[model samples]
Target chain A: MADAPAAERAATGRAAAAPSRPRRLGRRILGGAGRVAAALPAALVLLFLAAPMAVLAISSLNATASLAFPPSSLSLRWYAEVLGSQEWAVSLRLSGLLVLLVVATTAALGTLAAYAVARGDFPGRRAVAGFALSPLMVPEIIIALSLLYYFQGLGLVNTIAGLWLAHSVVALPFVVRTVMVSAQNLDPTLERAAASLGAGRLRVFWTVTLPLLRPGILAGAVFAAVTSLGEVAVTALVSGANTTTVPVRIFSAVQFELDPSVAAISTLLMLASVLVMVVVDRFTHLSEAL
Target chain B: MTSPDPLRPAPAPAAGPAAHVVIEELAAGYEGTRVLDVPELTIRRGEFLSILGPSGCGKTTLLNALAGFVRPSRGRISVDGADVTDVPPHRRGLGLVFQNYALFPHLTVAGNVAYGLKVRRVERAERRERVAEALRLVGLEGYADRRPRQLSGGQQQRVAVARALATRPAVLLLDEPLSNLDAKLRREMRVELRELQQRLGITMVFVTHDQEEALSLSDRIAVLNGGRVEQLDTPERVYRAPASRFVAEFVGAANILDGVADGGGVLRIGDTVLRTGLPGPERGRPAVLALRPERVRLHTAAAEPASADAGSGGAASGVLGYRAFVGDAWHSEVHLAGGATLSARTHAEPPPLGSEVTARWSAEDVIDLTTAPAEEAR
Candidate 1:
């Protein structure tokens, strides 16, 4: 690193000392080339991520009733149809309720667990944190399969409560991770000051600790909401016909045939997540939680 | 082992153990490390007692124990003659000011000050009165509506003090409250805290690592080392005659020299014999003498006699190694014969480096720490 800086300094000095116009032009061209070389991979990554969303959007606008790239003609018919369809609307509503339930459940549970993991000292603390965060580490397919069997044995496989539990379990780790980051950063002295100022334990947590955790709570809620909305495999296995979520419905619909309305629904789900994120970002800086 | 009966009736606080806050046989630790074990500490009502020590010396733990923040393994703490060892922090009714001055960021200055009153369920009118009175005590009356983050660091600490005082607790505990402020602010807050404690007539226990702060503001100082109080005395006494080696070295710039006590009114350090009024060890017993740096005077001497009476006691021949003038005083590092170095401070212009000089000190200033046990210092 030391030699590289010295070499760069020498090169710059030589370039400055050179009186030739051609040499200066050559160095400028080389600098531009190096800049492009470094940015090329990032540009390609952006394109790869955006291309599918663009394809999904354009295909949703297809005038014909088929899923094809570079749609032949543009039309809003699929959007209207998707919005009007009963199954689509029902699935959307079910997903919305489930997402709301998961966000609320995970945020509360995550904030409590994060407080324990970050601040409390107890026997088997590591074991408890690991158990709480197991879903994030283990394979999702295994979690889905195990939960499916468990729910089936309880005869709640098609129930909204069972689906809520599964989605909440899956999203719990994300919420805990975000909230834990904020919890660890919360100075213990603040709590001490509160206690010394005659605030009881419950009052301190409610008035002092909870208010400071607002950013973490909002960030965790956003993560859990988005994750629950887009969840597929677990929701597919646990959700019954009566409790069919949007992702579960989309998974089953793709098996029989391709519906352009699926694309429209996907766009709508993405838009809902974006709207949730925007609202949360208005209250707290999202990057602070991470 | 304790030293032979203190030579000068070692100066201490006028008030004895009859105190408003009393800690007895307190022992506390965390995760197997013993942090504090105070047999007894007594704080008189309306007295400013500073617990001065280096970091991890359990000064903070002692303050926390008194505040009911740290549970003792075995002890009893009584404030206002009421035992409160098992009491919780809020019920203990001892106010604590944190090092960070953790004023609630969400609350305005008035709201922060009124928190303790609100938690106690004081009526609206009384709460407002107490909050305003507290702010006025800290000279922050106009800043009632301002947020904590909007105030300067000095202002924030004043607010913290105001918040702690609003509860009207018997004893207020301050844990390094001025540590986060700049030097000037720290000095300013020191005066403010002392004045506040006096004006309110509320006892204050301050924990600090800064000895100057302790010396200037405290009526009595408890010098702690390795979770134990080495000495509890007036600041002037502690500075003039530290009870042990730790206090002598930790409190101020001290030049400790190896010596052997004679059977007379003198102790011998290398080739030099110094006069002493202290009742030191027996003849030829190993002894350590600590002399304050400012007490040592540097003189450019040539052809000095081997042994002669200098100013106060005697002088030792040495070469000034490095000399520089600080804004307040002239400082010079002198190299002696036995590969030991001694620092001297003089108000006069310092002699040049490598010049032969004699370091002289008064016999009265020689601290005899030979019998004072050396506590483990972190």
Candidate 2:
């Protein structure tokens, strides 16, 4: 009975001493230094992303004939010039058509391939899936060079169809990867339940499978459209004199002259990319796609 | 056995149309490993039959075969006298409710219920009416516009049922439909599902590994093991008169005792002779008896103090090993002199451990089997 009181006293003393030590140390070190450590890098990353966009937006309104930071005058002359140009208009039209075609074809082919790879069980399924997505592993320069030689040999050099095909090939892997991730996450029992409910194969695909795949298809289409619109490496190889996309035209202009027009055009492309990203983020969660 | 006269008026509505589903000589496997080998099974029309087994017992494989997901290597599956061996799942006109209640996430509750009718090219107005009627049957009439994600788990399950019933298929298959819910919810859903089936008079096949679920919901249960039906009988028959040791052990908890027959309708375990109501095997033959725990009575004193010398008292002495309170009953494990243990469930609080107690049971409660030798009884 005497030993019990001593033991109880010691235990209570230890319990009271234990929490205060950690609490005081946390307040002195982690509560102060740890917060600074967490916040500094996050602040740096945010500034790094925002500063360039802010400078670009401000410089776009510059009235000077040459590109400069902290411009003396602000005007919309560059915007008006870009919009008034027939060359820019024609290139914009071509880019629009290319984006539309690329988005539609990539989405259709990618969804089918994704469904097959993720859900279908057949011989050589893994090998076929790997082969379909192998384009992403190769460097863009290698793909462009190979396609250039291949198209030249086929007598399809410098044609719109050649550019369309090349862009689709590069864009397809992204769409397929995004859609396949979503498809793999879906529950397969849903398909079985659909079948048992008197739904035929086609009906099940349309009613059950397609609705669940909408977010994936939307994300992949946006990615394919944006990539096709701004693609340069592959477009450079296959674009003819008569068929010049906005990126190819901008590349040529930059090579010839260091002028504000290129900055203006690049700013336009940047805005378009941001716009497409925002639209995608609105409909489909970008984090889920990632 | 003499066949009943065909000319005589049949009783009880002719056994409810004579077993519409006939599965004959079915052998199925996955990736060259045979999983199911059911020789024959016949399910009567409008019957709520459950295939009960443990995991890896191929009960799900049997259900999948009936659902047309698995093609048997050698068999014929017929429904209403028509061979459906070559038919695909959709063409077989069967309704299935998955364990997770796989309702369509994109469509509203009404759209999901109308999917089958629309597939069959029902008129738009008629489709709407049927969808409304089906939802009403499941008591979800006003939830037609809600997507599956908007509803609770039980509501989603009801929508799945409504969708399957809208098609009016020849059979309904449920694959552990209530396994995902909480215990209380599972109980309520079981009652609701059983009531719905009886009200609709639908031929339903339910698959589950839970023994209580099988016994409570099914009119007859086909207890399966190793891909074959061990016993197909009414729940009471399967529970009370299991045809084999496996059935007796798997259906309910049974304490098996090894005994030797004395060729005079008597069996002995150690020095205790048992008066088995059933006939004994040949002299010196090995046998086993299954005794349910609830049937055994426990007494604090030795052989009631007055009937110790009488062999017909059906009493045996053992030491109380452990006692546990199991809500409405006390479960006691008693160890006999020969190191054998017996479990008995009693209404009274069990005696303390290490106390000497006598276990008593009636002769009619002992189920005797002579199929296997004593050492290999299990």
Candidate 3:
């Protein structure tokens, strides 16, 4: 027991004090080879993910309405048609509005739920946290069927409110999960310090807790927006003709009509997602949020 | 340092200076296991009091009870004759400086300082003035616009102090606030903190496990052990006249001696006997006493013994086991004839290791702890 500290100091001193010349050179060579080895797998994964999007982007430019890869001729007519059509435009607008509503609803609920789950020690707090993220655990088809049956009885089916409600449920799990991570990372001492400085509970929450949790809240909101914008199973079951979102419209159109227009709209949706991420990254350094 | 304007009117003189904060029958714990039990403890106004103890010794529990963070199952806490036991932490009007300097990362130094004022709906103009004043007090006036993360650790600690002081709390509570700093910075901050506390005349309650910090900074220290305050007195009394064995050993280096009192102003340790200044207990009674290392004097074995009042030991000679240089003094360990080791601290060099030496001390310097209450276990 008496020799432990001496042994530890000796070990640390050896590690920090010296590295032989040959060992240092070997390390540098190994480091360069390791970098290339790591990059190969990462590059392959990126290509695998990007290949389908590249094909869809190219197919969207086909002059003929038929969807084709390596098209004999290319033009922007399909993009123009998809942008100009009134039906497609309405579906796009509805989807955008629904996404905004879902993001707002989920963000508010997620933050509150995450705060309670992370800081509160009341009975069944773990159960409450589990329930918040249960939507992601349960199969989406089950939730879609249940919402369809429940909304029909209330005359909510075929209404914009119904679509908004369904999309929020689908997006809520993602927002709450992300915000929970942020809430857990937040230092409790900051809140205590605020309280000690004569700030009341509500004031501390507003000035300290909420502002510090902004990164998590924002990342969660982005996740909600993306999830709502692409939600299909629940929207398809609960939404009517006027309430149809872009994803639901595309789902139906693809089953009946196959054309370069579908590929063009798909490409546009993908571009919109990329643009949103870039804007979010510029504002909040999205990397830290995750 | 410039003395800032008085933060609040000094506590009313009618209540006297000694009862600024009072705790009566305070008992707090977690899950039915008692961690603290204080029958009564009073903190004087404008005094720096440190609750000193080892880890899990309930020093923090006592501080939390004072800060209104820990709800004592049984107690009445009052500041200036007003009961605040039921009040929430925010309404307690106490400033707390945490060990980690919990500065708001999202706010600038000025913003963090202005938070309490803003919460109270203070006028914006006065808020800015107070914020600037607080920054100046902590020597951070020009760094108001910097975020906490932009500052170094020491700078962030000063910001936390500034933020807490901006509110002008009735009593500032510090929870081991200096334990995180490096050794050199910790010493510097210790002096600065003492000066600030004196200048502001604000009642401060500091909690720490570092005995040196408590001994150096506190006007009065409450030395707690095993969820009980073993001694509460001024630093000189606590160190020089420790009331219990725990305080004697914990506060500084002490050589504890266990022996039987011979009822003749002497203590018998094995075959060796040492004369004591205090009246010895009844014959055949077991006694425990403390003798500080610095109080012990070392002399060569061949030298003539000093006067008897100096408690010169004829049979106390021992072989010098080891000697260590402790920056300012030489500490020599003497392995006694009775198998007990006695350590002595002195400025003058002593005989080389393995040489024979006699250890001596005045009888008046012995601290009798035989009657001190035994430590209670949880």
Candidate with best TM-score: 3
lDDT of 1 by residue, A57-78 (tens): 7788888888887787888898
lDDT of 1: 0.85
TM-score of chain B of 3: 0.92
Residue B292 in candidate 2 has what lDDT? 82
lDDT of all predictions: 0.85, 0.82, 0.87
| Model 2 regions more than 4 Å off | A1-33, B1-16, B262-279, B302-314, B372-378
Put down candidate 1 lDDT per residue, B117-183, tens digits, no spaces: 9999999999999999999999999999999999999999999999999999888999999999999
Interface RMSD of every predicted model, in angstroms = 0.9, 1.0, 0.8
Please give the RMSD to the true structure for each candidate, in Å: 4.1, 5.1, 6.0
The order of the candidates by lDDT, greatest first, is: 3, 1, 2
Clash pairs, candidate 1, are none
What is the Å distance of residue B289 in model 3 from its true position?
0.9
* Interface RMSD of predicted model 1: 0.9
Check candidate 2 and list the clashing pairs: none
Which regions of candidate 1 are displaced past 4 Å?
Answer: A1-33, B1-18, B31-33, B141-147, B262-266, B270-283, B302-312, B338-340, B374-378
- iRMS, candidate 2, in Å: value is 1.0
Model 3 spans with C-alpha error above 4 angstroms? A1-34, B1-17, B270-279, B304-315
The 10-residue segment with the lowest total lDDT in model 1 chain B: B1-10
Model 2 reproduced share of reference interface contacts:
0.82
